[model samples]
Target: MESSAETELGRRVASFRELGGLSLRALAAAAGVSSSFLSQLENGHTNASVASLRKIAAALGVTPAQLLDDTSVHTRGVLRAADRPSLPLEGAEKYVLSLPPLRNLEVYAGRFEPGGSTGSEAYVHGNSQELFLVTSGEVVFQLAEERYTMRADDSIEFLSSVPHRVLNTSDAPASVVWINSPPTPNESPHAPA
Candidate 1:
């Protein structure tokens, strides 16, 4: 019999595949594995090695941890507000709201002082999406050639594989939650450009 963790892993794997609308054959092909192996994994009939899990995760456009999570709790796997991780940025303080050991998605709670900004540079990553929700104060986001001003309770979602920046324009400290999918490979969550 498979361990409970392994069972949870299988369930998450299946869920993610279904969410992505992938057939077993298609997922197997993308992950460079046999359909039989993928089937065994989903059925909890075999233990999946780390290499195989990584391949499946890459093919599914998510982190391996996301594929292993059992998000059955009432919080939907969210980290409590007080338990968020704090990451130092170049000009602002970023508090990560999502639980780590994450898979396809990441959520953050960021606090920025007046006149602070994420960065002035433009960058791109591979196959990533991000969302920002202004929980308090005012913020400005520059995406490509467009400029957007966000107030409290506002939200924005966009592809992270483009040049973007966030600015705190209010006199009071601004707080927002930043969520991203598929943690950028080996990128450091606290690294500020």
Candidate 2:
């Protein structure tokens, strides 16, 4: 008999994949596992070993704990604002963003102090789509050849593959929520090419 914990883990894993808009075949390809095997695991018809779970977690851009834990609200996988992890970007000053464990789609809450910007130049991430919501103060977003000034309560969604940058245009701090599909590369700013 499958333990409740195991079943919950499987359900969470399945939900995470769905939230990321990944088909079983796509996740299987990324995890180097057979699609049938992934299906079986999702259905709780087979026990998944730790090693297998590790592979799945890596493919999903999450820690195994995020996959196995039953703490999140099952309906929406709500991660409380205080619970997200802070991630620093390269060449950005007075800025920090909460990059939640990517068990599902990537969601981040960013804060930028006055005069802070994402980087000196724009960047393109080919594998994902992005949604940006300005929560407070003001932000200047440069997307490709267009520039937009966003104020509180404004939101924009676009292809992440387009060159984009964010600048805090106010004298006070600015806050924005950024959501992305799939996962961005885990390259460190200081890592050598």
Candidate 3:
């Protein structure tokens, strides 16, 4: 195919692709584009449609704006609620803190709905330490073989390696803030490429 008019998009694509640690074939498969086509885009021999760019961004777990925006610089350290990312757990929503990625600690605010449970199965988090504070409502927390019925302003700190989980026993919503050191295994980055 013929090359597109001069543009710096190819450079950006290559840069982000490398940062995402994806091989040409892997990225192509994820982006739903042929390997040869991705090669053309990377080599500045072709242009990509908006759809293609969006797909690539999703596959890389980023927004298309992040890929297209030239103003990538942003302030760190202080995180606003609007920018804080959240993850969905089995029966709760967890707002992730804005700590440095390399930091050994992780912080999250969890909101649990009525009758919500953290799943039937108890899970472990290696040997990391965890602290959970109930901001509102009541909950049933089980750590290893022990169970505790807690209410607002209640908090607990324990080893994450224990098989534990929580259930919101109240009719209203329950909220908790969690802090963990040496983040859980599943939360870590994908094994350093």
Candidate 4:
């Protein structure tokens, strides 16, 4: 018997595939899954393995976690830290604290060890803005040519268009709470910076 989670996942897969205007055979080919298997998955008659699911998510231009995100809970709700969704980005771990795919905001908690970094290359988000508060230790933020060292309890805001990267500089682990308003959906949420 198919679990409710599998049914919901299958529904979301079909919905996203339809939204992308992809036929069952086309998506199956792109995801490297058999058309019959894809059909079964879409019909909630079968469940996909993690590897297959990741392939499907990649073909849809999303991460596996994105496919798992429960977007149906869009109304107001509270998420405890233990139940938050997490993604590994660069050398840090990012825990999503806010309901995603929404137009309003994205809240995330990032934890990093010494020498850990958001990414090797800087990236731009275009027309977005972010505010982050240092919760513990220190973080080195590089925006273009300027570098800002943020310590515990420090907060900063900057435009997303400016290419930037975050790095942990302290010997101890560092943590921060990030708030990005008007989230960018084009980029992979699993990526850091």
Candidate 5:
């Protein structure tokens, strides 16, 4: 039997895809997933990873939180910290600070544990410009071939299309804020060069 969470996720995906007037195959192609896999996902026959959900959300032009939430009540101006949706990945955590119906802007809070990193590989996404700010501790950012170590209150702006990654080598946890204009789209980290 499919878990309720899985069923709800599938339903949300299907709903958003339909609302966008996208065909199953079209959304699948845009999300870089096989049509059969998308079909299975929507049918609740299988589960999707956070990465896959992110891709689908991007393809739909909505935040992943929008897909996860049952209602948009929290999107009406302010989103409380307690109500914030978070994605906890391997050694790293991310919290969405922007609400749904995001026009050309999106904001996120990132937390990295000691020795944590975004991933071993760098990634590119969409055409939006991005601004990253280190709120606490320290983080190392690798944008293309250049690397920069950023401390608290440090920030940098760059194009989202550039391959980038973050690492926290300190013994303490690091916090960061990311602001992206023209929300990022469905481009997987492992996308072909």
Candidate 6:
């Protein structure tokens, strides 16, 4: 029997895919999944693996957590730390720092373990303005061919459309705060986004 969570995930996936005007085949192609598998997932006949969920979320222009979220419960208010949503990235943990109904801005906090990275392939989102601040330790931001090494209290601003990646090559952990103005639909809801 399908669990409620699985049913809800299927519903959310179908909803988002429809909202994006993507056909089942189109979404499957974009997410690198078989159409039959996606169909089964949408029908709640099966649950997606985390890797599959991540791929689907990326194709849907959202985070895996967003796909699993009961967004009806999200509201604008002072969100307590414990109530904040978190996403585990590759060797890093990302905390969503802003309340839902995000419009003008979105915030995220990332803690990168030593040698952690935001993957080798850089990611690009809509053309929103972005600010990245290194709150603790050190980090390297690779934007296209440009590279910047930032340390504690250091900050940088750039257009979010640039293909970029974040890395902590140091032996110690690193923390960063990222901000985006006029949230974009294509922005990933975790890590440096």
lDDT of each: 0.74, 0.71, 0.72, 0.78, 0.80, 0.83
Model 2 C-alpha lDDT per residue in residues 73-178, reported as the tens digit of each score: 2433444656544555532322223233344355566777888777778887655778889988898988898999999999989988888888886788888777
Model 3: per-residue Cα lDDT at residue 184: 66
Candidate 1 achieves a global lDDT of 0.74
Tell me which residue pairs clash in candidate 5.
Answer: 104-182
Error of 3 at 103 (Å): 1.0
Could you give me the TM-score of model 3 versus the true structure? 0.55
The digit string of per-residue lDDT tens for model 3 on 8-91 reads 566667666775556889889988999998888878888888999899777766667766664441322256887767776667
- Model 1: residues >4 Å from true position, as ranges? 1-83, 191-193
Clashes of 3: 0
| Cα RMSD, model 2 | 5.7
Arranged by lDDT with the best first, the candidates are 6, 5, 4, 1, 3, 2
Best by lDDT: 6
Identify the candidate with maximal TM-score: 6
Q: What lDDT would candidate 5 get against the real structure?
A: 0.80
- Candidate 6 per-residue C-alpha lDDT over 1-193 given as tens digits, one digit per residue, 9 for 90 to 100: 9988888889889887775567899899999999999999998889999999999988876778778886822332256878778987778888998644355788888899998887768887788899989999998999889999989999999998999888998999999988988776754665458
Pairs clashing within candidate 2:
none
Each model's TM-score? 0.56, 0.57, 0.55, 0.57, 0.57, 0.58
Tens-place lDDT digits, model 5, residues 32-137: 9999999988888889889998998899877888888867422333567877777765588878876543555678888999988778889877868899999999
- Per-residue lDDT of candidate 1, residues 82-160 (tens digit): 6666776656888765443345666667888888888666556554778778899998878888888999999888888
* Model 2 local distance difference test score: 0.71
Cα displacement (angstroms), candidate 6, residue 151, comes to 0.1
Clashes of 5: 1
At residue 13, what lDDT does model 5 achieve? Answer: 86
Worst 10 residues of 6 by lDDT: 70-79
